[model samples]
Target: MFWFLLIGLVSGWLAGMISRGGGFGLWGDLATGVVGSFIGAYVFNLIGLSAYGTIGSIISSTVGALILLWVIRMFNVAPAAAKKK
Candidate 1:
């Protein structure tokens, strides 16, 4: 549990930095990272890839975080575009 939280925090923080400027916040980042880890594993598995260990978890989380951010951005843009039309 401790390792999981630590990994989530680190991965989330890293992902935030890579994707945007910074994280949503400590708790938000942790949540995002944890969720992203699962997402990443699922996504990688779909492509027949698997990640292992701490480093692999971070990588997977980052990838998943990027996807999550992208989806959020898409939704954000859609509403604006809809309002314009």
Candidate 2:
């Protein structure tokens, strides 16, 4: 549980960092990032890629987190002209 939380924080921070540097604040980024970690882990496992418990695992998780965040951002970004129309 504790390890998961730490992983969440790290993954989140990394995700936020990779997401174009500074749109969301720390807590918001962290929250998005934490959730992203779970999504990332799930996707990774589904793809038959295994992340061992090592520095490499952390790196891969971070990459996965960034990917998740990117996808989420795309979904959340409403088309401005569409909104007006």
Candidate 3:
């Protein structure tokens, strides 16, 4: 559990930095990272990939976090665009 939390925080911070040049604050990053880890595992499993240990977890979480952020951005854009129409 400790390692999981640590990996989530690190991965989330890294993902936020990579995706948007900064983090989504501490709690937000933690939540994003933890959820991203689950998302990463699910997606990777679907694609026949597996992540192991700390490094693997970080990589998977980062990829998942990126996807999550992309989806969030896409939805954010849609609502605004719909409102304009």
Candidate 4:
């Protein structure tokens, strides 16, 4: 539980930095990062990769955060496009 919160906070901070002001508040970011961690793990598992309990896990979580940001951006842009049309 503590690990999840810490990981989530760190990952969320990184994700927010990478996204260039695209993320929400602390709680929101934390939630995103935590969920991203799971997503990353699932992805790694699906592709026959191992997400162990170390730095590799952090990397995997960050990768997942990147993917999550990409997804958020995609949906975020949709409304703009629709409004323009």
Clash number for each model:
0, 0, 0, 0
Candidate 1: give the clashing pairs. none
Per-residue lDDT of candidate 2, residues 1-85 (tens digit): 7666666667667666667665366676566656766677787888878777845456666776788776776787678887666
List the candidate 2 regions with Cα displacement exceeding 4 Å.
22-26, 54-57, 78-85
1-85 per-residue lDDT for model 4 (tens digits) = 8887888777877788787756668897788788889888888888989977757777778778878888887778466568667
| TM-scores for every candidate against the unseen true structure | 0.84, 0.66, 0.87, 0.76
Best TM-score among the predictions, by candidate number: 3
For residue 38, model 4's alpha carbon misses the true position, in angstroms, by: 1.2
- Residue 45 in model 1: shift from native, Å? 0.2
Query: Global lDDT for candidate 2?
Result: 0.68
- State the weakest 10-residue window (summed lDDT) of model 4: 76-85
How well does candidate 1 match the true structure in TM-score terms? 0.84
Cα deviation in Å at residue 7, candidate 3?
A: 0.7
Tens-place lDDT digits, model 1, residues 1-85: 9988888888888889888778879998998889888888889999998898989888898888778878877777456568667
Index of the highest-lDDT prediction: 3
Whole-model lDDT, model 1? 0.85
Which segments of candidate 4 are over 4 A away from where they belong?
A: 21-24, 78-85
Q: Indicate whether candidate 1 or candidate 3 has the larger lDDT.
A: 3
lDDT of 1 at 57: 85
Per-residue lDDT, model 2, residue 2, is 68
